[model samples]
Every structure is written in C-alpha cells, then in structure tokens.
Target: MERAMGISHFGAAAAACVFMLAQGARAEEAGPHLAIELNAVAPAETGCLISFMARNGHPAAIERAVFETVLIDRAGQVERLTLFDFGDLPAGRPRVRQFSIPGLACDDLGQILINGTSACEAGTLGEAACAEGLDLSSRTDVELIG
Candidate 1:
C-alpha cells in the first residue's frame, strides 16, 4: 500500500510539471510581441528573391507578407517592384519569397523596401498585438531599406 501511494504521488508531480511547461509555452505566445528579419537577398532570373527569418517575438502567426522595393539604374531611373508574398511564416522560422521584375540586374538594384504585410491578422493576442519587426541583411549587390 505504501508503494502504491508513492507511485501515485510521483505521477501527480510529473503531471504538474507537464502542465506548467504547456502554460509557459502559451504565455510566450501571448506576451508582447512581433518580430521578423531579412536574412539574405539573391538575384533571380527575372528579378530577385528575398529571404526573411521570423523570430518568435510576435504574438500572431504571419500568413502572407508583402514588401515593396525600389530599384535605380545607372541613368538614375527609379523603378518600383513588389516582391512575392511569403506564406505561413511561423515564429522562429525562415521563409523566402521571390519577385519578378524584368530586365533587372544585380548592379541595377538600388534599395529594397518593406511596404507592409497583409493577411497578418491578429489572433487571441489582442488588436495591438500584431507588429512589424524585421531585420535586414545583405547577400547581394543592393541595399535594403525597411
């Protein structure tokens, strides 16, 4: 009987620990949040491709992300290009989206801009929970401006 009681006590303690762990994860997803970053950029056959890494700093998941970029030529002609939308960007994960801009080369790229995000609806976090948090890194010949 004593052994049976001890076993039950141990089982209860383990269950408590599991519950606490689950709660902690939920809390992290609920706290003040929103973060994303651009890790690299590469030139595609048509235009360019940008890689974005989502850090677990946002309370909501990003379904689709949109960005607008500006390109300049040697003759000082400015052009606007919209990158492809990234889908299902979860926290602490990375996603890549490509854009098609004809006749654009690496050297002609002046700057890249992050216009904003759509379909980034806020979940149970709150109305003010969704935020734009991104970091930019360079892997190509152009400069990125977010």
Candidate 2:
C-alpha cells in the first residue's frame, strides 16, 4: 500500500471503496431543492472530486452504482454531466457509508450540479440503496463533503 499523508493505497481490494468514497458524492436530476452534505470537493485528472454525506444516509455496501455529476449553468440549465467509470462492487462490506466524487473542484459549487445512479434502489434506508445483499444508505449524512 502506498502511504501518503496517512492514507494508504490498497490495490483493487480498495477499488470499490475508492469508487464509493471518491465518486458517489452527489446526485440530482434537476430540481430547486438540490441540497447535499458536502465533505470535500476537489478536482482530479479526469473530472471532479466530490465527497459528501447525503442528508439522507447511504448503505455501507452496494451492488452496482453510477455517479451523475451535473454542472449547472448560471441560467439554471444542465451544462455538464459525467458518469463513473467503474460498474460494481464485491460481495462484502465496503469502506464507505458516505459518498465520493473524483475529478471535481474541491472548493467550488457554483460550477456544477450533481446526483447518482443506484442499481439497488429498493430497501434503501432513508437515502440508502440496497439490492440482493448489497446495501446503499439513503440521505442522512452528518458531515457534508463537497
């Protein structure tokens, strides 16, 4: 594992964790009450990094997930929308109860809109999305990371 600033890099074992804690941050098709508990919003090589806690919490493990990052224009129109590169997770506990979005501006919100795509939309606790045996919590996060 590569340790940098107290953070280790745990190969593909941590791949899903990285994806969840680094991609599943924000999600909203298009609405007026578009709110989120942002943890840390940064910019990456591909797009953006948005780490946030949904006011509606999410599950610890999930089956499959897709991130939808919306860049809202000043005119309130959907300007930019990007999806995740990964597809699913292993059948086990994940390292993220919250969400993360890579390639985002860590210090800017006035530049984009955001949302997510969950394979397990059922049994979703509050803001979680669970399916098969995978869990994805609903909106109810304490810390806003974005």
Candidate 3:
C-alpha cells in the first residue's frame, strides 16, 4: 500500500507539471504585441533624421503601418504633426525605418508621440492589430509615447 501511494503522488505531480507547461506555452502564444522603439536620432542637412526599430510579434504580417506622429518641442509645444509610413513589418521580424523632418532640429526635439494608427493593413487581421497591444520605448534623449 505504501508503494502504491508513492506512485500515485508522483503521477499527480507529473500531471501538474505538464499542466503548468501547457499554460505557459499558451500564454506566450496569446500575448502577441507590436513594439516600436526610437532607436536613433541625428541631424541631417534638411532637418532631423529619426530612426525607429519596429518589431511585430503577431502571427500575421503587417503590409503597411502608418502612424499619426507628433513632434513636440523642448517648450512642450507641438512642433509638427505628420504621418509616418513604416512600410511592411513581417511577423516575428524586426525592421528599422528612418524619417527626415525638414526644418526641424534634432536638438530642439523633446518628445515623439504616436497619436494613433493612421493605417494598418494585415489582411484578415484588421487594422486594429498593429495598434492593439502596442509597446513603445526610446533609446535616445527624446521621449517616445504611444
């Protein structure tokens, strides 16, 4: 009877471990998100050059991702509002896109705001897929907000 009870306890523990592993895998699969980071900023002859590192964790690829971006000055004033097209973002892939803002100085910039998703083309995934579960970060002095 003692040996039988030990075996039963071992089986129960193994089943619990398996259940926990399955739950963890499902959580990883379900928690898909889009991460956009302000990777770099530099001064161009025309204006400021901004680079963004975008990663798509979704299962489907995003054909086009356009964001309504706002550039804020050091005085906390809106400097410029424009649409930045981040072309195609493949699933599980990272891409870098650079945009040049004419007449804007890199040193004068304070913050970069992703106001909203202007467009997102991901076929059946819909336009909301890109903006939903969006993550934002910055590597430069300029603050990035979504």
For model 2 the TM-score comes to 0.33
Q: Write the per-residue lDDT of candidate 2 for residues 1-146, one digit (tens) a residue.
A: 23663344446558778777655453222211112334444566665555543222233333345555565544555545665423333333222323344443434444433355433332223223421222222232222122
Query: Candidate 2's error at 4, in angstroms?
Result: 58
Each prediction's TM-score against the native? 0.53, 0.33, 0.80
lDDT of 3 at 65: 95
Q: Rank the candidates by TM-score, best first.
A: 3, 1, 2
Better of 1 and 2 by TM-score: 1
| Candidate 3 local Cα displacement, residue 8, angstroms | 35
| Top candidate (lDDT) | 3
Task: For model 3, name the residue pairs that clash.
Answer: none
Global lDDT for candidate 1? Answer: 0.56
lDDT of 1 by residue, 1-146 (tens): 99999999999999999999999997665664544455555678776555555544554565544444455554556766454455555655545544456666756666665555434434554333334334455555555555
Whole-model lDDT per candidate: 0.56, 0.39, 0.94
lDDT of 1 at 43: 76
